[model samples]
Target: MAGTLKVGLIGCGNVVDYGHRPALLALKDVELVALADITPARRLIGKAWFRLRERQLYADYRQLLALPEVEAVVVAVPQKFRPRIVLDAFAAGKHVLSEKPLSNVPAVAAQLVAAARHSGLQLAMTHNYHFLPEYQKLKQLLSQGLIGAVRVLTLHFLGVIDYPGAAEYQADWRHTLAAGGGVLMDMIHAVYLAEWLAGAPAQQVMAFVDALQYAGREPVIEDLALLQIAFPRAYAAIHMGWGAGVGGLDISGSDGHIRLRYKQHQSGGFNQPIELYSVDSDWRRSDHAIPNLDTHEANIARSFTQLWADFRDAIREGRAPIAPAAAGARALEIVLGAYASAVCGRVISLPLAAADPVYQKGIAGIAELEAWAGSKTKAAGLFGLRA
Candidate 1:
């Protein structure tokens, strides 16, 4: 709390470039002291990016964890590989800042949360979307009752860019079964945002999961996810996919409505926001100006920096970060619930039962659940279901 925070980084993946790299470099009180990657090329890339000595680089993350200098670590590996590393970090007596989706399996995610809770160490999520300029402005307006109590929220991320992972590892790992669900799981920022904006945990979910982008390629995942989530007093519809489609945010409140559109209709975080406005009950429109309307990349970089600062202060002040591991676990369950809704053609309840197959095994559980004969998810051959 009094001095700089020494941090270690695991997995030198592409996310580190725009997200963690800037934060580690920009935050004066945070220092990225050690780097670890299974790939030599990625290790070299991280070494150059962080300017670490050869001794500070490691092929095995355990070696980095053994370093007593590291007070915390940022785990940037794929979801499937995150649990062990995070659990190990807790065992090593270090706080952890894990990448999104926490883990591919709900059971594993719960274990990680329990581990962090037992260790009394900080376990924050890389849910930097909470700090994005547009979303921050949106939250502020909603909090001020600019449109009265929210009744319905819609987030369109159909234009999500399908960026590949580090070439050193499997570049298209996101397209594989091990990555979990698909577009919905990949862009889980929208899922948690729905909960945060609604001011309540999700109560139920219904969805249509398909693979329009890779339909004929024998795809194992869905590129398209249309979800309808129900909260106690509000509902949210999230339309997401992997190709160029609609992109924006719309909110309907008791007194008015709010809208946000991105430049060139690209998804948020991919392009700058071009317009944000609200309409009152009288049909009068009031435009809101987004501060620091810099390049989308710059805004993303800043969000991560702010998130890192929050993680640092949370550890020092003995509090939870803006996005904690429990939030990540909840978000993951929401996505998995959407998948189950698609497969079963029914509204799946929230905080899925521990005995539920989806709760036990993530996307893989889809194959075990009773499938609806006419379900589009099954028709599309997603989750190992045959047409």
Candidate 2:
């Protein structure tokens, strides 16, 4: 509505404080107009931290959206509530930038996409890992045919879901499936990366999910999931867990191979390093580790800032957002397909229908797991096996 993009942020949670707030503040073209959270303390904290006028704080998101000055809304709420907020923001004639795993469920994600499309508003899902320097370099290499024809992508991302020093309250919400807890949500970066590298649609998926070991706390969701996705051109595998472990991604192609290794911690500081092996005169290897580089955290912030800028540009230009709502819906579909395959003991095809038994069973299983996990005190391992 004005020369500067007026941004209203919803959900002043850990992510908002650590990631989005600083990044948005750094962007010159954007103004942080308002903030909304269910908790009064969080709203107060954000207002104090950002030095916003008292009137800019609201307890309800609907009230935030009703503000004429708020041209765009960033839905950084928990994954379970993302779909509703995204749809509502679009309906309110505001562009939306949502945190990852667009929705906890696929069906709701699809509805949100449809609503955004019909309303002709921007909807962007923040998958920040793709913007990392290493990833960007890898993409450039692949596009330039340095890796030749991509044949396989393997990603192993594992870390302790409940580590020491983490807030007890944070664990409470994360341990529940209703709050979108799982290796699925935690390790979704790998899934999206694999799909991005493969440059092909995921055709089918087969997954084995279990509630393996946790850090002395019951996980209301599957802590470990091994997913095998068959894309049109290449096959991919993702091994994700929430226990003591180390993980990375390996991409093998016709002529070269690249590996990115890191210790998985949810917050940041897991840059790891990238190793490349290429066929030249002889097989040569090189490591491109930046000196004292905190690429992971920097990339996360940069991705959000760039994503917000792109949303504003799209709106001003009357064009679709960089990662449109449909793409977000498709990403959720791919994730749901993996879950369905794990539940039904079969490969689930793409474009899943509403009447599919696997989808029904998947939802039921998630619900049951959540209920069972909440009542247990000890860390519940994978649903079917050890992590």
Candidate 3:
């Protein structure tokens, strides 16, 4: 590693534009050497934003990777294409940073993780929430035992989305099943926070899924779901939805409990702290203050700075990243388990076997809903959704 590693970034989508690009540009230790995006407009946008020359802008990522001066790569591409891109970056001897769901296919993601470990290159995931001040404060409080021995984790994530209607085909790829889009796409983050707070692996998962507004339209992916995960020493329930509901988290411990929330709108943006409460009944009740912000996307850029710093330090000091490939792989595996549970119509024990159909077929477990549907039309709505 040199004093300043030259960076080549792929994907100029929303995340790269608002989250990573700003963070990378602000870092003093690295040069933004190259950028790649399929969209010509986006390529020009990055070229102008970072002041890169036309020769440094590329339509094909491989051309960017060919740069001998490039020492690392940031991959914010779609979940499906990441395996190939990340693997290519590693083959090109570049340290990698990737945006999550690691892979829509767990098996392929596992391979990517293995490559990072065996290749001796750092692989960082953009799970920036873990780096947020509020979450950092929560982690600190837990370490101090403000709430002792957390046993239950509950998260309610509610947001609104217009039904795809006749324009389903033209909707954001996140709304499509083939792209691994669904209410649970961010379920991995909730699962990560739960495990981080609880200190255990989710041993099992059981879930129910619904497309709701698209009930009779045979949605390619669900927009609603409830995931129940059992840990070795505790349990977690995650309710994810695309329509009206409250959003928050509750953590219950042997001695006390903590509650946290946010208000999300298209305009004001995310993580606008609603409240944080803790009470033990014997001890004093505490109310912690949260941020008042203009946009959640702003904090995304802020937290990403910490995430990128973690990546840089890991590469510099030869340590694992704050959010490593294994952590992402574990979270991804649990999410897939919930999908399998929905299809199998039963509790799914985790450490899902390599041979599990979902491992290779990705969300292919959803297909089983067809056979499982039988004469149970209502049941089919859970997965084998019909018109």
Q: In terms of lDDT, which candidate is strongest?
A: 1
lDDT of 1 at 242: 92
Q: Give the alpha carbon lDDT tens digit for every residue of 260-317 in model 2.
A: 6653322122544544334432457766543334566666677666667777788789
Q: Model-by-model lDDT, in order?
A: 0.93, 0.69, 0.75
- Per-residue lDDT, model 2, residue 344, is 50
Taking the tens digit of each residue's C-alpha lDDT, what string does model 3 give over 1-387?
569868998987767767787788889997889999877878887888898899999999999998999988999877878889999999998999988888888788889989998899988887877876567767777788888888888877655343332221233676566667576774456778777877877789888766675667667777777889999988999877776466778888888988877755211124566667888847578987654333566676878887888888888899998889888888887887777776666888887788777776677555644334422323545334453
**Tens-digit per-residue lDDT, 81-178, candidate 1:** 89999999999999999999899888889999999999999999999999999999999999999999999999999999999999888999998998
Each model's backbone clash number: 0, 9, 1
Candidate 2, superposed: residue stretches over 4 Å from native: 160-171, 215-218, 263-269, 274-282, 286-295, 357-362, 365-387
The TM-score values for the models, in the order shown, are 0.99, 0.86, 0.90
Residue 210 in model 3: shift from native, Å?
1.1
Worst 10 residues of 1 by lDDT: 378-387
**Which is better, 2 or 3, measured by TM-score?**
3
